[model samples]
Target: MGPEWIVVGIIAVAVLFGAKKIPDIARNVGRAQG
Candidate 1:
């Protein structure tokens, strides 16, 4: 949709999981899928 929604989604994710853990979790998920 729009950039505002994108940003809101990001903030929601960051709040759900701390910002520091997001990158690590993403990297692990990528590696597992790849």
Candidate 2:
């Protein structure tokens, strides 16, 4: 989609998990895929 949609998705994730945990959540997700 567009850049606007990308930003919205990021915001949604941040809201769902809170800013402090986003990086940790991303790391866990990457490890799971790997």
Which candidate has the highest TM-score of all?
Answer: 2
The number of the candidate with the highest lDDT is 2
Query: Which lDDT value does model 2 have at 17?
Result: 85
Cα lDDT computed for each candidate against the true fold: 0.91, 0.94
Superposed by TM-score, candidate 2 places the C-alpha of residue 24 at a distance from the truth, in angstroms, of: 1.1
For model 2, the stretches where C-alpha displacement exceeds 4 angstroms are 29-34
lDDT of 2 by residue, 11-31 (tens): 999998899999999899899
Candidate 1 residue-wise lDDT, 1-34, digit = tens: 8899988987998999999999998898799999
Candidate 2 Cα deviation (angstroms), residue 12: 0.4
